[model samples]
Target: MADHRRPPPDILVIGAGLAGIACALDLSRAGLSVELLESSDGVGGRMRTDRKDGFLLDRGFQVFNTAYPQVKRRVSLRDLCLRPFTPGLLARTSTRLVRIADPIRRPGDAASLMPGRVLSARDLAALAALTTRDVLLPASILKRLPDRSTAAALTRAGISLSAAEELLRPFLSGVFLEDELETSARFFHMVWRSMARGNLCLPAAGIGAVPEQLAAGLPDGTLRLEAPVVTVTDSGVLLQDGSERPASTIVVATDGPTAACLLPGLTVPDGRTVTTYYHAADTSPLAEPTLVVDSSRAVLNTCVLTEVAPSYAPPGTALVSTSVLNDDRPGGEAVVRRRLAELYGTDTSAWTLIGAYIVEDALPAMVPPWPVSRTTRFAPDRYVCGDHRATGSVQGALASGTRAAREVLADLARQ
Candidate 1:
């Protein structure tokens, strides 16, 4: 099956995740021959979805934020049939469920946000100032702000310790996949701005549809699946199947660890772990598509998936997804079910477990002074791109990929 007469592609992108697909798409659009190789059976390295027993389960509890700049540029939101979650989250405190909603967005929830109910006067003032500044100002201004641990930033802004523990910590632990708010303050502000500006939604099909859409833009025969690259040869790469493909340039667009393996001396940050549990019930527990976090800290976050998008489950069935920062705990399923019962205020004993996904490297640790973007040029001919090289997010991945393509194009032009 060798086409010896035909020349090798100008560029070989080793990975078909969003970053690789984006790189290949940009390169090909510029009229270069590019091939994308995926180690797995399909694209969407981490964003993959599985259909089990007629239920659409995402690899993890994933939500697409329409506010991400890269998402808007790269995806057609209309085609995904997006369904939005409520603008705010519910915190299951000791006494009752406290609903913290955006007054401007959800005017009806204005009653829930009245002073002394959810957030104290001081906490409300501090958060309002933070949200208003982050939303109105440009990213450049926010990024230039002094960097510190997110916890420090919140405290410095006058958010009360009680509010941090009750509302912010529980909600953000799910977002950052870290219980401690040690992530960069800059990244936190940016994320906060995006949340305030955009709709947090899920696609009718699944989060995997986002990547599937990007891969569809590639030219025919541009992608090869299950073609794992064992090592980077001098002239190209050696595939796991014992094949050598030569190329003028190679971009390692895999995850942090894989990129480090392919391109030695590359810096790979520490990663966070997360586990998501999917449960199927005969009836819906929560009628609204809202995220619920526990002040008890038993579960990071949980939501009724079918409430957001009916297509996630078969007719008349409800799908609930819950995520914890770590893998299976000692108590396991029984513990999670009990926690869910408390959070949703409904008996979860009858709910059947669909699947549990433990993602070891859910997101790269974004410590203080982390670069928003980094150069992808690893060597003269070798390059790398992923969320690891930028902020750990969908926007970061896509942005890094496009940046790599630009760098490759410039390098090739000079040759």
Candidate 2:
């Protein structure tokens, strides 16, 4: 039997998302008594996965980047059994489908990048220079560059407008979840650099497996699920069931909106909404593990998940994932299905609708002049951390949590 009159824990982490998990893990490893509470039955807030009818559908279309420094620090890549996507894109333009490949990664595919295929000689040279600077130059130097929209940054980099519109806009829009390419130039450069330096892959199990792995590392009795916190006071959090959990310190590590609800006046950025549709196909539309983007901006991006990792689908069936900006329209799935057929140049009529997920606050917007990181300490003992406080990525979430843990440790040491 547990002691009901015991003292409160040293740290109480609200939310079991990546940020909360990372913070709690760090605090516990440092010999602190921590209590991590989650409202949901499982972990991974936006990074969730659904298993239905032998198909694995992620909450939204997501990819794991191997170049994330935080991910490399916390996760074992080998344990995830990651499957890499091709280091290029199959872009659909007004005229034809363009095949773009990284010459450094695929030397034999270099011919596909010749002038007039996807980009002009001048544009290609400019792109090469930009890639070299981003991938080879130090991040400290890139961070020092002027803060501006990604579109303006590309123009300044000497990339032609044609190349920007045809290739960069379509591809990067999928990444930033905005079609205008108006995200922060520093953030864009870092994303591009990561792609250039590492491979984009998927876990053999599902995207949710990433957070599950993080949760598995925590010490027993530290995590409590289905423990919805109604309010957070200076002392601790109050549950909806009229139960109060007292703690010496608290960390709010939830989504942008939820965090704002808990900590009033906490500025939460406007988030990007996305809808992903999963379809079970008899066969994959494309044989290769490449992402297809539409230059017309009809849909954000589409890929055959089974092609990337055969384990994502059952035997003899393919799982296709399509993502589009959420517009709250009727019969949107039907419209997307038609577009998918056109993009793949195959009949999608027979494809079965496996699942559809519409995420309201998928990611925080990273507009120009945005601070790449923010202060995590809210008060003497209260703190807040999430991707919203950083660059709106898994890396940001993990990094922010790590920062919060360091702040807590430092404050405790001072005491």
lDDT of 1 by residue, 154-252 (tens): 999999998998899889888888988999998899999999999999999999999999999999989989999999878888888787888879999
lDDT of 1 at 329: 70
- For each candidate in turn, the TM-score is 0.98, 0.97
lDDT, candidates in the order shown: 0.92, 0.90
Q: CA RMSD for every model?
A: 1.4, 1.7
- Candidate 2 residue 1 Cα shift, in angstroms, is 19
Instruction: Write the residue-wise lDDT of candidate 2 on 170-268 in tens digits.
Output: 999999999999999989988888889888999999999999999999998889899898899777889876788888799999998999999888888
Residue 50 lDDT in candidate 2: 81
